[model samples]
Target: MVVAGRIHRRHFIIGAAGTAGAVVAIGANGVDAPALAQQTTEPQNGKALPEVVSWKDPDAVIVHTELTVETKRDKIGTSGITPSTELYLRNNLPSPSEEAVANRDSWEVSFEGVQNERTMTVGDLKRLGIETVAAVLQCSGNGRALFDHEASGTQWSTGAAGNLIWSGVPVRTVVEALGGVAAGRAFMTSTGGESLPEGIDPQTVIVERSIPADIAMERAILAWEMNGQPVPLAHGGPLRVVIPGFYGINNVKYVKKVAFTETESDAAIQRTGYRVRPVGVSGAPDQPSMWEMKVKSWVTHPLVDQQSGRIQIFGVAFGGNSAVQRVEVSTDGGQSWREANFVGPDLGSYAWRPFVLPVDLSPGTYTITSRATDASGNVQEEVTEPNHRGYDYSGWRRLAVDVTVT
Candidate 1:
């Protein structure tokens, strides 16, 4: 049930309570035995095989059947905040070593291109101040699974997203301590700490991206905590950037460096990746980079496989850099729409708002859809244009469910 404009926290407790035993068993030695077993599988030819660890959550609804993980829509509202365990995982590279994340307090983030260039340990950051914010962290390719044409990346559906509460100091606070951005720097580039395979050239690998200086000095956060707990390694543990109202890619995880630069980073990930282009468009320069998230909504209840009757339809709506002004639900495709009642208080401009609509229907097949309008007057589109990499799709999402009303 929804309350105070947020999913009731009780729902998450109950859902997690069911798995508490398993969590304890697997976490006995503070190790993921299943993951370790998978990594230790032997090859028939007796050759040493590279370790393969699966980051997929067994309880989550499988969307891409690969690195891209997504939560079950029906389970989304169980908690006001997505539980860290239930949260989706998206990694462009293999998970870093535990040894690297063990000494959380010792993890240092280097700052450059400022008056006082130096490295500050996580402990040093804590002494400055602490702030908290509730925001949504969603993959740019979240709805790629629904694209008419096959997409090359993770085919995530509705579950590749979550609303989370992050605790840390504002990135601007740290920047100010470094004597602020250098005179000519217009961008702040962040890099992750993951190590690559032996043969790969470090230069060819692009794990860093840059954001405009304005954004960095605004709502960006250097978060070390999630849901009141230390951020786990699987979720960018030691330190990560949390840029509210922006796509998850912009919130680089396991951050190691923050560089202020006069020009955008030339890193391949910064220049060539995360661009939205038409099917045949090949170059990054020809496409626009995804920054601010677009206004979007999702219908999470009466899931695609749910039986319908007297149902209460509910889901989430979020606007990038603006408040969600209103939400509309359509029971008959896009033919008709009715305003949905929003539940919960407005967390912030960057947080997702929950909306509910109660409906009575007869036995039949139905197509349900949701659309949102931001306070800035931006409305969600009925259809999203197909792009080459399937990035930044904020189109009205449709849910088809069969009903056997008795």
Candidate 2:
């Protein structure tokens, strides 16, 4: 995949002129300026960084203006598992170096706040055991583009999510073997080893975020594989944390360290970012961090301008921690609804379930909406309150199409 603003190893210093130069000039005693410069200047064996995966069918997805990738609503329901190539990409920072991606085997993950406090390699993790699970990985800010409040972040729609099968060792097993977590630690903060650009202070950068310790020990996995293939560089190769039923932000990619803390991580990404607050409200402690995803569904079969006599509309529904009980489709702007037929076997609680509805219509304009009800009875809201960060939008999915019965 070719990302718009591709950064090469050679370009690190030049690209980060302002930040790198400032860091070099400051040369703080505690900060390792020389090491930072060395990292920036090191050549990647003269090889360019790997290109981030891009959509083969441009029409199949919507490429954000900022290059944050998202699949198109109409192209999503074709398969129960979203293809690795078709999966959306969301990166808080630039991609890691090609060298880093190539030498993944040597990478070690350190675990802290445990009785043993040990480090483990991917091989060690596999030796313990391999477990595969199908789960949804969704951006917290999905559907932000549709919000009327105009939040400041990636303006995503329904395509900012996908259901994929992941293969890895359960986090609980790993933690238990490491002498188990110490008491009083309620959060597990994970960090990636990816190098940062020149100008930014490594300490200030928020590469890590914390999740509840219970969730980490329960449903989280140290995933190294995606859809039977090794995790791609763009999708956090080597290893990543996959927390089923949680938003994607908690699934830290390129994981290097897992620290058990008594309190929530104060990293910028954890504290100041990804919070659900009012448009004007801004502060770390005031806003709540986004966690479990809300029940949501989208119409994917009929393209916006699709023309047909008998249209079959289908989409995927996910209820985060709960199983989706039913999905209802409305043909008349949600004035009424009809239960849609589920199309596939239930993968799991974390995986999305597909639903389809067949409708016959003459030439006219139509608005279609889909709402999902989970086992917990959490129904998709008709409207979601707009937040400052555009996170956790779980409203009824809607689509407008012009049908021509020729």
Candidate 3:
């Protein structure tokens, strides 16, 4: 029973940078069916389908990317959060071989960064103070599937995000063990020659990116197992990079190589695509993408219960660099709101804080919305919050349901 190391704690403020509006607490209100429908619009190019990825059997259905709102609704009653089993899969390339996805063979990962260059198999990685941590891995375009203005790439439903307990070697030790490479200022990750995926654009599939070696060393990891078992091929198998706080694209899968460099390269996903202007800014210059986590929250429990009685509202919040200062809930469509009490104050940034709010329902329809505010006073917005590329960071999530009293 080997366990991976835990994410180190730091003093990161909760919430985002710029925000407006005052925080207020209010009681439940009547629902508006037409208003809710108008707020959520359809994508431009008709309706898109959920792209499914599988390794072993043709029916594996490992991951689905660029999904549409209708597809998400048909699959899961909720959209924002995808289940671990049905988690939409994304790979730089297809599986290297059928055996890699079927056979439960051991794996090996190499560490080549500015400090030191070395290679360690899965067994060796597990022996070095192995630990497991539960964190959220969300695509930068997770909610893009819902945006009225469509992005060129994957039309991901909120389902592009998943929370799993990942196990592997601590990236800090991997970087530190390499005599701490001095020449390179950034860390590069690669995978073995045997495991590259098939049919993927050679240029776009295999991932490689470099961040300040110091930053990568602080939170990087060679993840070998996910959710208490070997990571499925649909996800990254054998090994993957679990860098908390950054977009899912930064966490490269099927890693075969790692390097350290003094200068950043625009060859990888972070350099060219998946990069967007920060929140609240319009037409801002694009910057090299790094793992910048914003304070975000979502409501999961009772997403839409037709047999509604005394429904209990529940969900989780996470901010890698900052702590979730407050999580607020609104049943009146953001016009009025109430603060949902945190499980406690001592929760960690990497760990999610589960919140519970019991609300009594009447014989009518309702819309449940949740918002998060970080310690830095960055409050979640109700709409897109007006970003440059229309990239959605943290915003209010609304769940609709109709009720009838017997």
- Model 3 stretches astray by more than 4 angstroms: 1-83, 101-106, 187-205, 277-290, 305-309, 342-347, 385-390, 397-406
TM-score of 2: 0.84
Regions of model 2 farther than 4 Å from truth: 1-50, 54-59, 65-67, 305-308, 397-406
Q: How many backbone clashes does candidate 2 have?
A: 3
Q: lDDT at 303 for candidate 3?
A: 40
Q: In candidate 2, what residue range of length 10 has the lowest lDDT sum?
A: 4-13
Per-candidate Cα lDDT values, in order, are: 0.72, 0.72, 0.52
Kindly list the per-residue Cα lDDT of model 2 for residues 1-406, writing each as its tens digit: 2121221110011222243222121100222112233232212232221245432233344556433677655557545777765567788876676665576667689999998898888878888877898999999988787666667877787778989889899988888888899989999899977777688766467578898899888888999888877787777888999999999988888899998989877777777878888777885745678788888887665544334456777778888889888999877667789999888778899999888898986766566668899999999877666677777876663222222232
TM-score list, all predictions: 0.84, 0.84, 0.70
- Residue-by-residue lDDT tens digits, candidate 3, 1-406: 1011111111112232211111111111222222233231223333322322211111112224332121232232222222344345555444455455454445555665544566666666666766676666776665554454545556554445555567777777765666766673555544333343568765554466555566677776778787666775557776777776666666777666766666654454545545566443433115636456667776654443233356666666666456667888776556678888765434345555666677777655455667888777877655553333445445554222222221
Candidate 1 has which clashing residue pairs, if any? Answer: 4-344, 4-345, 5-343, 5-344, 5-345
lDDT of 1 by residue, 342-388 (tens): 87777888888888898987766566778999999999866677788
